[model samples]
Target: MSESTGGTGEGTRAVRAGLPEPVKNEPTLPGPVFAAHFHLPGDVEGPYTYGRDENPTWTLLERAVSELEAPGRDDVQTL
Candidate 1:
């Protein structure tokens, strides 16, 4: 239960859970990214190189799930 959703109804909490803060020119929920490979310059030292290995979509999902499961705890990690 996030601080925002604390003491709120389950439906409300579920709907509000894991939502990112509002940005000026961004959607409330980002669209999915579907790329098998990313462009890497020089050595492969960037965050994403292989889709199967890591993805921004999954990262956001994990964060959301973690927040739902363990709110206010940065030590929690979801997969």
Candidate 2:
């Protein structure tokens, strides 16, 4: 077990990290999005153009790691 911080245990924090706020009909934890390619009309104007480059699953994992490592600091960047 790891140390606790901000009155929350490491295990607890890890479990709750990166979780978005509750929605009326949305699941508490969203399922992973698996895709090799996304629709691109003309040019790649959006963040997610390729699966290997970027995806919702990676974004969520990054958020979770960032939260666990830096808590309330939004300036923290996770790779």
- Whole-model lDDT, model 1: 0.70
Q: Give a tens-digit lDDT track for model 2, residues 20-64.
A: 866988788888665677574687576676667678878788889
Evaluated at residue 9, the lDDT of candidate 2 is 79
Error of 2 at 28 (Å): 1.4
Q: How do all models score by TM-score?
A: 0.63, 0.68
Model 2: weakest 10-residue lDDT segment is 32-41
Q: Give a tens-digit lDDT track for model 1, residues 7-60.
A: 666566566667686699888777777667756467567666656767787777
- As a TM-score, model 1 comes out at 0.63
User: In model 1, how large is the Cα lDDT of residue 6?
Assistant: 47
Please, what is the whole-model Cα lDDT of each candidate in the order they appear? 0.70, 0.78
| Clash-forming residue pairs, model 2 | none
